[model samples]
Each structure stands twice: as structure tokens, then as C-alpha cells.
Target: MFFTRKAFPVQFNEHLPLNTLIENIVFTVFDTETTGFQVASTDRLIEVAAVTVKGCQVQSSDTFRLYVNPERQISQEITELTTITNEQVAGAPFALEAIEQFFDFVQRNETSCLVGHYVAFDVLVLKNELKRSKFHLKKLQHIDTLDLIGFLAPSFDMRDLEKYAQAFGTRIYPRHQALGDALTTAYLFVELLGHLKDRGYSTWGDLLQVTNSPARHLSF
Candidate 1:
């Protein structure tokens, strides 16, 4: 299926710290289970979800979830995993365009920051995509729950997604869909927040240095 590219405006935001943002800023619990791991050539985002949070509370009304037409064919394995076939997204809006629109929406409508599991991957893919589309990442403070999970539970040996679902006691619904995974990620993050608070740290800065993924420093 052929897709027509739509032009979108780029936004540059001030450096709003996530710790400070968490108190007053809303939280967009964001996640993307993409078509593939790589963000460059052969890989593109197939689905994306953002759950809105105010004062750390999830608000269903202020959420965004979409299945994007990647403007290309999803592989057999990916299609089976996500249950999103080429035909399903053939006429849908492009993924990049959807993200651009989502960015504008979030920047304008919500007073939130972003939270994601293995968030560096999301950030990396987003920055790379923006660069490809000639956009800037004014760079808001983003919280990475993968790092949080590890920092919070250092002894926990987690190698798979099921492990997280088991450890956090959060249900992983809908398997490969973006919103389902994001919702689970949000639940896991909330659990992590409780862990941090129990440890006498209520601010993000107190945990930022210790909660970053080891690979995140390599690129993010």
C-alpha cells in the first residue's frame, strides 16, 4: 500500500525535570512495541500508546493510542505477534505522522512528562525518527522504568517480559498492542514509585543517577 506523507510542525520544549514535573506536571506513560528493534533502515514503529497521568494518577480520558500504517509491510512474525496486519493499517495514518501529531497534542494539551520501560529505546527511536524528519527534541526529562526496575530490585534476575509481569504483579494484557503494554508499564512504574518513596526518595533527581540503564549512557 502506498502512503502519502503529511507535514507536521516540530516542537522544542524547555528542560523540565521529571522529578519536579512529577509533582505538578502530568505523566504520559508512553510505550511503543515497534515492528523491529532497529530504528534506522528496515525498522519502523507500528503502534504507539500514551496514557495520561495527573499527579501520578492515570486518567483514561487524556490518553492516545493508535495503530499506525508503517507505510510498509510488517513481517510474518511481527504481524502474528501484534495481530496488526498490513491490510489493517493500509489506509490508516502513517506512524511518523501519528507521532508528530501526538507530540503536538501532548505539548499543548497535557502538563505531563514521559515514562517508559526501557525508555532509552523509545527515546532513541524517537530522536532518530525526528532527525530523519528534521525535527528537534527540545528534550523534556523522561523517566526510564527499566532502569527503575533494576535500581529498585537489583537482585531480581529479569531476562524476559513475563518476568516483569510476574515480579511487578502487573498484568500484561493484549500482548503486542502498544496501549496494553504501556498500561502494564504504567502499573509497573507506579509500583516502582512506591519503592522509591519507601526508600526515602520522593524526587526524580534523587533516583536519576542510580536508575539509568547502563546502555542508556552509550546513546541517551
Candidate 2:
């Protein structure tokens, strides 16, 4: 059954204390493959993937991946990029079921914030999906690895995930697939975290300060 907003209330910890060390913080890194880029209408998710990270390492056992039946035809361009086909998702669960599982997976830790590459798009798609299910996501905190990379390496061209992975030496096996991209984001995040740590940013507050700095503007 699809969850209603009242049934599954997500809690946001945006203002929560961030005194804890980064090493002890739990992060739920995720990625999604969708039918298209238009989040305001029509587009739907075809796949979702997530991994839990702590102490700068991914918990191999703690992962989530789901192929969702988008209920619409996928474009050939999208298929070429993500390699997801209608036949592959024909027998899979629908959006609501897959979203329920994703919520449960991330909600395992209340303090865990979401991490993604160009995360806004993924979040927008998830929000739209939840609205379809008559639910809404709580205002949760998130970190964008793309933004972090921009802040750290301003000279690097922020083109695509492949560029970021190659520049940072993060392995992206089977690129464009949900799980593969999520794993690659996790590795890139860990490396970025190390850079932040070396720059004396050891707590979530410190990281947020940098991310929200007025001087740091992100493009792409």
C-alpha cells in the first residue's frame, strides 16, 4: 500500500546540533534514474539506489536498489544513458512501493543526511513521486557532492558525473545505472570529506558553513 503523508512523517534535522565529528556522522548517499529531466510533470523514476556511509566508509550490507515501473515509455536516449529498458521494469514494483522501501532504508538513522551528485534533481523527482502517492517528504538536510567539488576545485570543469569520477579517481562501473552512480558518489564524497577535514572542517556545522558560504557559487 502507498503511504500517506500522515502515515509516514519524515523529520528534518536541518537545525539539529552538528557538534559530532564527521567520522561519526552517518550519511545516506543515493541516486536515481528517471524517464526524463522534467520534474514538474510527466517524468517518472525507473530506478533508485542508496548506500549508507559512516567513518568514511560504505556499509556494504546496508544498501537499497529498486527498479520501478514508470508506467510510461522510456526514450531511447534515456535508455542509452541509463541502460534501463521497459522490459527490465515491466515486472518490477511501482513507484509507491519502491518509494516506501527507500524511505524505510533511509529512515533507519534519523541523523543521517542525504548525499547525492546534483542532488536537487533526484530530490525533486522523489518529491513528485511522493506527491503522486499522496505523501510529502519532510524538509531534510542534504549535501551535494557536485557543490563540494566546485568549492574545492574551482578550476575543474563541472560537466558530468563521469568527469567528476575520473578527475577524482573514483571508479564508476556501469555508469548511469542508479547503484553504480550512487557508489561513485559515495567514493567521491569520502575523498571530499578528507579535503574538508584537512582544511579544519571536522563537524557537520563546519561543512555546512562552507557549502552555504556566499562566495561559493555552483554551476551545473
Candidate 3:
């Protein structure tokens, strides 16, 4: 069943004040494995994963991951990168079904901040897929770890998640998979939150204000 934009009401919890402590805030860290880079063109999502964090800790039981049948052939290069072959997704649910489950998972924590590394790309792909499926996600507040890392370490290469993880002394095993990346980002986010706290960013608003500063010019 396709859900129209108005099918689900925007829950009131999403408006929770941002003045609360950062460690106390709930966060939903997610990642997507897509067919290609361009969301406006032919790219499609093949996999997605989300993990919940609260009190600066990852909740393993609250994780969600799914393989999506893109309804198109998986490219050889993509297969090489993600190790998600065409055969693996042959019986998987299509984008519409998979996204529905994803939405359900997210709605469980309507007020949680959405998080990812290079998050804009993942969010764009998800939004585009929802549009194509005739569904709409409730507007979400997002935190991009890439932007945070860029602000903190201007000289380091911010595009590579592995590099950032290494700098933080975090390990991202089985990299490139959706779940693995999400877990890695969650760890990096926790570490970044510590640095932000040390720099007087105790509230969600404080962190957002700093990351959105004009001087940073963070693209992610």
C-alpha cells in the first residue's frame, strides 16, 4: 500500500525542544547502500540500516536492517563494493515494502535526531525513494557526523568514514555494509559528542548552532 503525504500525521513528539542535554537525547543513526551516487537520476537503494542511541550508548536491540530489491540489475562495481550480489536480493522486498518497514522503525522514536556520516547523500536517496513510491517521511532533524568532523578536524580528509573512525580510535569492521557503517558512525558520533561537550556544546541546539556556522561552510 502506497502512503500519501497526508496519510500519517506528523507526530507532536517531533517538536521536542532542542535545549535538552546532548547525552540524554535520543538519536537514530542510519546508513544506505545505493546503486549509484545520483539520487535525481537512475540510482536506487539496495540496503538500509538504522540503530538507536540514547544516553550516548548504542542499543543493539533497537536496530533495523534490510536488503531492498531495487528492481534493476546490481552493477558489477556496486556488487564488488557492497558484496550484495543480484542473487542476494532476488527474493528481497521491493523499495516500497522495505521503506515502509523503515518508516515504522523510525516512527517509534519520532523525536530522535537522525544521524549519519555524509548524511545528506543518504537522506537524499531515502527521500527520493519515498517520493518515487508515493510516500512521504515526516520532516526529521538531522546531525551529520561528517560536518561535525569537518568542523573539528579541518585538515583531515572528511569524506572517508574509515579515516575518521581511525582518528577517533574506533573500528568499523566489515565496512561498506549498511549495518556496519551505521554502527561505525554511531561510535564516531559518541566520540564527537564528547568533544563537543568539552567545547561547551551541552545541548542539541548548541551543537547545531556550531555546525551550521557560516565559517564552517560544511557541505555534508
Candidate 4:
């Protein structure tokens, strides 16, 4: 279905690690779940969710969620992990349609850059599909949360979300929903942003350098 276009609220980015380009800034935090991890072979994306975050707040009204019909059946093993079954997605909208909508929503509302935990892998999956569709999905400015958290809390222990959540005094919820994970990541990202501001990391480039590599931990 060809969408006619709709206006969405502006997302946020002025406070990000970027320099002085503050006008028309926004950011989109997104996540997706598929039949499996490998986007290259048989696995395909089944669900995708995203939210616009501005001023360190998730705009609940400006969220997107969709389930797509995976041409192949989802394995029971994968289903157990994500709680998504092949029947749930059967006859749903096509992958192209869901992605097209997500692409447009993000392009219209998003700024700054796309971000998420383990964002690199997710970006790879979307980029590959967008390339195949010849869609105009932006190769985000790139922010891998695992790297960011490492940079800020060099002394903080535990890399997994469960451990991190305990460190932050919150319980991980909904386990594996895309939107649920995105919400959790959003909270963590804002905390990192605050930490950066406190430490004087005031440019996008400055923040990006640390996150571009693996998270570094301090000994002792």
C-alpha cells in the first residue's frame, strides 16, 4: 500500500553528543524481532517497534508497532523465546508494507540518529532489507548502546540487560518484546546522556567515538 504521508511530531537530538547543529533535531529508538537472529538466510523479521524520544522522554503517542507475515514458518524454539508464533503472523501485512511504513514514520519524525542496544546488528538487518527494496532508509548516525554504557560507567559491572537492570534498580519486563526492549534502552540511553553531560561530552562526535568500539571496563 502506498501511503499518502502524515505529519508526525518532531523527535529530539539537540542534547545528543553532536555539536551546534540543533535545529530540526529528533531521534528514533527502534527494535525488531524475527524468526531468528540471522537476517541473511532463512530468518525474516516478524515484528518491529519504534518510539520517538525527545528531551529524554519517550513520546508514547508517537510510537509504531506492526507484525508482518513471515513467508516461512517460525520455529517452536524461536517462538518460545519471543512468544510469537507463525499463526499469529499469518495473513498479516507483508514485510515490505510494514517496513515501508516504519521507514516513512522514522524519516518524517526522527533526527539525531537511530539508536538501540546492540544496534549494529539491528541496523544491518534493516539496511539489508531496505537495500533490497530500494527503500530510502537512512544508515543511522550509529550508536551501539553496549559501547556507550561501557564508556560512561567504565567501573560498572555486568553487560547483559538483567545485570544492568539490577545495577540500575529496575526489573527487566516483558522479556523479549521489541517495544519493551526499546523502552528499557531509552531509559538507559538517557541516563548515559546525563552522565556524558556531567562529564562534559557535548558533541555527537565525542560521544560516538567511545561507542564505536567495544565497551571498555576499568580494572580495580
For residue 99, give model 1's deviation from the true position in Å: 1.2
Backbone clashes in model 4, listed as residue pairs: 11-26, 12-26, 17-203, 17-204, 18-203, 18-204, 26-111
Deviation in Å, model 2, residue 17 alpha carbon: 2.5
| Model 4 lDDT tens row, 103-209 | 67877774567777777666656655554455434223656667777787778657676567657654355767788777777666766776777787756566666
Please rank every candidate by lDDT, starting with the best.
Answer: 2, 3, 1, 4
TM-score, candidate 3, is 0.87
RMSD of each: 4.9, 4.4, 4.0, 7.4
- TM, every model: 0.81, 0.88, 0.87, 0.78
Looking at candidate 3, what is the lDDT of residue 164?
88
- Rate residue 76 of model 1 by lDDT: 88
Tens digits of per-residue lDDT for model 3, 136-167: 65556677887788777778875888988999
lDDT of 2 by residue, 1-220 (tens): 8543533465533455678788878888899999998856999999999988889887757788999999999999999989999899999999989988887887775445788888888888887887777776555778888778877898887658888888888767578899988988888889889898998888977877767633222111
Clashes of 2: 0
Note the Cα lDDT for every prediction shown.
Answer: 0.68, 0.80, 0.79, 0.67
Error of 3 at 195 (Å): 0.8
Candidate 1: tens digits of C-alpha lDDT, residues 88-150: 778877766878767865676553457777777777767666556655454365677767777
